[model samples]
Target chain A: MENKTENNKMTDEERLELAAKLDKELDEFINSLPKKKYEDGWPEDRWEEEMEKHPFFMTKTPEPGAELHPLYEGLQKLKYDPEENEPEDLATSYKEDGNFNFKYKNYRLAILSYTEGIKAKCGNPDIEATLYNNRSAAHYFLGDYRSSLKDCEFALKMKPTHEKALSRAAQCCYECKKFDLAVEYCDKVLDIQKTHKSIIDLRRKCIQSLKLKERNDRKKNQEEKKKMSEEETFFEEILRCGVTIEGGLGGLSLEKLEPCFPQLAAHRVHFDENKHLVWPVVFLYPEYKIMDYIQEFNETQTFEEQLLQVFECSPEWDREKKYSPDSLNIYFENPKKKLGTVKLCDTLGMVLALKDYVVKGGTPSFILLVRNSPAENRFLENY
Target chain B: MDWKPRHEERSGTLPQPSQETVKNLKELLKFLQLGARLDLKALALESLLAMTGSEDGIKSVLCVEEILVSLVGLLEDNSEPIAKDSAACLINLSADIHGPTYLLNLSKNYCPPLQSSPDTIVKECLKHIFNKESNIADECCMILSNLSRDEHSVGLMFDLLKETQYGFDDIINIFTKVDYNTRGAKLNYLGPWLSNMTQDQRVREYILDPEKCVIQRLLPYTEYKESIVRRGGIIGTLRNCCFEVLSNQWLLSEEVDILPRLLLPLAGNEEFDDEDNDKLPLELQYLPEDKMREPDPDIRKMLIEAITQLCTEKQNRKYIRDKNAYVILRELHTWEKDAAVLTACENLVDILIRTEDEIGCDNLKEVDIPEDIAEKFQKLDV
Candidate 1:
C-alpha cells in the first residue's frame, strides 16, 4: 500500500512540473513575438479602449488583498455620488465649461455657463466673483454696458477685495459715463495698490473732466455778467474820452497836442544839435518844437530844469530805441520836482522810463537817472 | 629611618596644597590653556580635570561666563602651545552649558579672516575646539576639512587626511578646496591616500580624485561589509566617475563599468530620473552589449526599464539616439516576455522608428526572425 501511494505521488508531482514548464514556454513565446508583429495588424484604437477598460495605468494588478478599488471604478463612484453632484460640484463643472468656451472664443456660451455656475453656487465667493467678472467681460464685448455694470457690482459685492471684479466695475462705470463712480472704484484700486498706473490714469482723466466742467460753468457765468455791464457803462466813459482828453495844462487841444507831442518827444535842447535826445524827440514829435523849451531849460533857471537836464545828459535818453517786456535797462525818474532825471538801469528800461514819464504820464521836467547803466559817455563825446 | 628607597627618593614630588581643590582647578585651567610651555599646561589642566571631574569643571565653567571668554581667548592664542592649551581647556570646559558659548565665541571671532589663518597650529587649535564627544564632530570635521584644503593649510590637510578616521565625506569636502597650495601636492598626496584604502574607501577616493588616479585600488573597497556602505560607495564613486567619463578625456575606458554600478541603486526609486543624471544608466547598459542576452531577467528588466525611461524622457532622448539604443531595444523586444517588458520593447521600437539613421536605426530590423511580432511591426503607422 505504501509503495502504491509513493508512485501516485510521484506522478502527481511530474504532471505539475510539466504544467509549469509549459506555462514558462508559453510566456516566452508570447514575449518572443516581435514588437511590431503584434502591433501591426491589431486595431490600435480597439487595443487602447481595451487597455483603458482594464485600468492599464494602475501600479498593481487586481488581487484579493489590495487596499482600494481600481482608479476607473473610483472615478465612476465619484462621478455619481450625491455629494459630488451638489451645488459646488455644479459650479465647478460649469466653471470648467466656461473656461473651455472662453478658450474657443465663444464668449456668449461662456457667459451662459458662468451664469449657471453663479446660480448653482450663490454662496461661494470665488465662484460668485468669477462668474460676475467673466459675465461683465462678456457684456462688455457685447456692448451691453448696463448689464456689464450690474454684473460687475454683484461680483464686487460678493468679494469686496476682488481685483478683477473691481477693475471690471471701474471699466463698466467709465463706459456708462458714471465718471464719479468710475473714479471711486479706481481710487479703491489705488488704495489697495499704489502702483497701478492704468487705474491711476483713468482716475486722473475722470477728475480732470469734472474739473473742466466746473471751470466752463464759471466762465459762462462771468461772460454773461460782463456782457451786460459793458452795455450799461458804454455811453459814459466812451463818449467822454472819444479821441480826446478834455483838460490839459498846456492849453493844447487833443488833435493839436497829438502832433505837438511828437516833436516834443525828440530834440532835448533848443536847437542843441549835439544833445543825445535831440534827434529822438525831434524826429518822433517834430511839430512840438520842444527844442526851444529844452534850450531854455538848459539855461537852468529852475531846479526842475536842472533835474530834467540830468536825464538829457544820458545817452539812453535816445528815444528811438525799442523796448520789450524783458528789457534789462531801467531808468529811475523823480517826478515830485516836475524834473526828469533819466537813469538807465539798462538801455531798454531807461528808454521806456523816459517814454512813460513824458508821453504817458505827461509829467514835465521829471528827473531820470540811470540806476545801473555806465556813465553818460554820450555827453562826454559831445563835450 | 634607613628604609627610604633610592627609586622613591629619585622620583621627586611637589608638596600637596592645603586647598587640594583649588590646586586642581589651577592646574586644570593651565592644562586647558596649554601653551608652548606644553608640560606645565598639560600637567596643570590634566591634574585639575582629574581632581575636579568634568561635571564640576563644566558646571563651574558654565556658571562663570568670564572664564569661558578667557578660554576662548586662549584657544585663539597665536603660540601653538598656548592655542593647544586653550583648546584643551575649552574642550574640558565644553561639557558645561557654557560650551556652546565657546563654539559661538569661536564662530564669531574666528570665522572670517582668522578662518584663513596661515599657522598650522592655530588651524589645528580651531579644529580641536570643534572636536567633541557631542555631534559637534560633524561641524568640526567640516571646518577642519575646509580649512585643511586651504592654500596655507593644504600641506597640513594632507597630513590630516593621512589619519584613518578621515572618511569619504571628508575627502569630498576637502576636494572642493580651490586654493590648495599646489596642484602637484594634490595629485602626489592623492596616490598615497588611495593606496591603503579598502574597496569602499577607494570608491570615495575616486570621487575626490578629479584627475583619476590609479583606479584599480578602488575596486576592492567596493566590496564593503554593509550593503548601505557598498551602495553609498558606488553612488559616490559613480557620481564622480560620470563626470570623469563624459567630460574627462583622461579617464580610462576600462573604468566604464563604473557607470553600471551607479545605476544599480536607481532601480527602486522612480523619482530617480536619469534625465537629470544624463542617461548614466543607459550609458552603463550600453557599455556592456553582451549583458543584454544575460539570463537574469531582473538584470535585463532593470536595464530595459532604465533605458526606456531614458529614451522616454525628452531631455535624455538625444543621448539615447546618439548611442543607437533603439537597435538593442529592438533586439530585447524580440525576446521580452513580461507585459511591462513588452511595453518597454514597443517604446524602444517606436523611438528607433522615429530616430534618424545617423543614430543607427538601420539595424533595428536585422536581429529578428519572429513573424507575428514582425507583422505587428509592419502594421505600425509611423
Candidate 2:
C-alpha cells in the first residue's frame, strides 16, 4: 500500500477549468440517474426530497467518447458508471468510520460519516436504521433539535420498535418546546417497554410543563378579564360624568374602544372607596420644564379646590409668588391647535367635559402657567 | 391601495345578531354540549358553520358565550370529519373582533372538559399550530392568524408568547420553514398574522429588537416566490415596522440594509452605465436582462411606501440617495402601469431628487406641510 500521495502540478487556471468541468459532469451524472418509483423507493423525505436520493459521496462516472473525461459527453459514450464497491461493504466501512469519530467526540465528522453510510443504500434495514439513529445522536450533541428529530423520524420509519430512535425523538421534541409532541413520543416508547425509567422521567417532565402551561394560561385569563371589566367600569363612569370621549382628537380610531386607561403605563384611572372616579391628572408647567403628577384628583372636585390642594405647601418650583389658586390660568390644546383657556371656577369633570379636552395617551394632560408673567408669554408663544 | 387589510379578502360580513337569533343559537349549540353522538355533532357543526358565515349569525352564536367550549371540544373527536368541521366552524367565528374578544374575555368560563386538554382557546390554538401531526393544525394556524389581527386580542397573545418560551422566536422558526408542518401547510397566513400583530408597539419592538435577529431573517422572504400571500404579508409587516422612525438608521444601514430589498422589486432589467451602477447597492447593480418588477400592484405600492417611511429621517434619506435609488425608480416609472404605485413612487422620487440643502430641514416628519402657499415657494427649485 502506498502511504504517500503525489503532489499536484496543475496551474490555477487548470484547477479552475477542472472545477467547472467537474461541475458540468456532476450535473450530467445526476441528470442521467434513473427515476424513482415512490411506492417501492427508499425515503425521499429522509433525503430532503431530492430526486437523486442520498447524493452525498460517489465516484466520478467517466464521460462519453473522449479518452479523457470527455466533452459533448451526450455525444458518443456517456455511460453512467457508478462506484465498483458493493453497497454493503461501503456501508459497513462508513459505519465503522462514524463510530471511530463518535468515540473521539468529533460529532461533526461523525455526522458526515453517518450521512455517507445512510446514503450508501445498503439492502439491510437494521444497518440503515442504525446509521440514521447514530446521525441523530450527533445532531443532538450539536444542539440541532429539528435535524435530530428528522433523523429520528427516518430511523423510526426504518425500524418502528427501535428504542434509541423513539427516546431521542422524545428528548428532541422537548428541547424544541413541543411538549405535547414530546409526550406523544414518550407514550410510544412506553408502549414498547413499560419499565424504561429515563423515558418515564422525560414523560413526567413534559407532563409537568404542560400543567404549568395550563395554570399560567388560567391565571393570565383571569387577570385579563378582571382588567377588562375594571377598565369598563372606570371608562363608563367617566363617560357618565359628561367627559366626551375622543373630544375630536381622532387620536383614537374608534369611539367605543374601552378607554385604554392603562394603569402603570401612564396615569391610573380608578374608583375611590367613596365610589367617585379618581384620576391621576398630569399638569405641565412648560416654563420650568417640570410636571406635577397629581396622584389623585376626584372628578367631583373643582379646579379651584384642586389648585388650593396643589399649592398648599407653596411648592418647590414656585420661587416668584407664582402658581397660586388666584394667579393661575389653565389651558389645554384643542383639536385645531388653538388654546381653550378654562376658568378657575370649573370643576375637574367640567374641565374634562370641555369641548377642547382630549384624553391623550390614556391620561388627562393640562397646561398650567402664571397669570401675566414672562413665562406665560413664552408658553402662549409656543402654544 | 396604500394599506389593504386582509378583512376585504375574508369571508362573510360583520356580526349583528338579534334576540330571536341569539335564542336559536343558544339552543342549537347544545348539540356538542351533550357530547358523543356523531350524527347530532355533525348536524350541530353544519348549522353552526352556517351561522358563522354572517356577522349577525355569529353575534347570535356568541351570545351563548360558552360556544367556544362546544366547538373547540369537538376538535378532539375520534371522527376526523366531525373534528374538521369543528375546526372550520371555529375559524369562521375567530375571523373577526367580536368572536376573538369574547374568547379572550371569557375563555376560562368555557374550559375544556378533558383534564389534559389545553385550558383556553388561544393556548389550545398555539399548541396545535406547533404540533403538526394533528389533522386540525392548519385550521389552528388560521384561527391564530385571525385572532392576532385585533389590538385587543394581541395583548393576551403577546403576553402568552412572552411568558412562555413559544415567543416570536419560535413562531418565526415555524413560519420560515416550508416543511415545518407534516400536513403540507405552508403556513403562509403566519405572515399576515404576524404583520397584523405588529400593530402593538411591543410586538414591533420585539421583532425590531437589535439584540435579536428576528427581522433580519424575514428580509430574505421579500423575494419568496412560492406564495404571494406570504410575500405580501412580510412586505406589509416591514412597512408597518418602518413606521418606527427611531429604527430608520438601523434598517437602512448595512446590518439590515433594507433599502436594496425595497428598491430591488421596483428595479427591472434596464441597464445603467458603470458610473450609475457603482453607486447602487451591490444587489441592484447590473441586474440580469430577464429581471422583472414585482407583478402585484398592491405589493409594489407597499414596497414604495416602506421606502418612503424610511425617508422620514434625514440621515436615512441621505443614505438612500447615495445608494443611487433614483435610477431604479426612473426605470420603474416608465414601466409601471398601476396609478397608485406610480404616485407612491413619485412621492419617494420627489424627496430623493432634491438635495438636503434644498429640502431645508433635518427631518421630513417635522417639516409641517406648508400652509398651501409655502409649497409653491418650496417647489420653486423644481
Highest TM-score model number = 2
TM-scores of the models, in the given order? 0.22, 0.48
DockQ comparisons of all candidates to the true complex: 0.00, 0.01
Error of 2 at B322 (Å): 1.0
Instruction: Give the alpha carbon lDDT tens digit for every residue of B1-382 in model 2.
Output: 1233333222233455677766776676557743546798788888888878987677677657667777766776778888788888888887755667765555455543443433466666767678777677778778877777766677777776665547777788788766888977778888888888887788889889876667877887888888888888899899888988899899886557788888888888786776897788766766665778898999998898899888887888888999999888888899999888888889899999998889888877776655675667555423
List RMSD in Å for every model shown. 35.5, 36.0
Q: Which residue pairs collide, candidate 2?
A: A64-A77, B14-B55, B15-B55, B15-B56, B16-B55, B16-B56
What overall lDDT goes with each candidate model?
0.44, 0.76
Q: How far is candidate 2 from the true structure (C-alpha RMSD, Å)?
A: 36.0
How many backbone overlaps does candidate 2 show? 6
Writing each residue's lDDT as its tens digit, candidate 2 over A1-383 gives 23333344667999999999999999999889897755765565654443322223223323334243234233222221125467776777788878988988989989988888888899788999999999999999999999999999999999998999999999999999789999989978976876688987798688667755654554455456557776666666667776666643334222333234443244356678887767677788887898777767888898899889889989787787677888988888877888888788887777887766766554577888888889899878875
Error of 2 at A264 (Å): 89
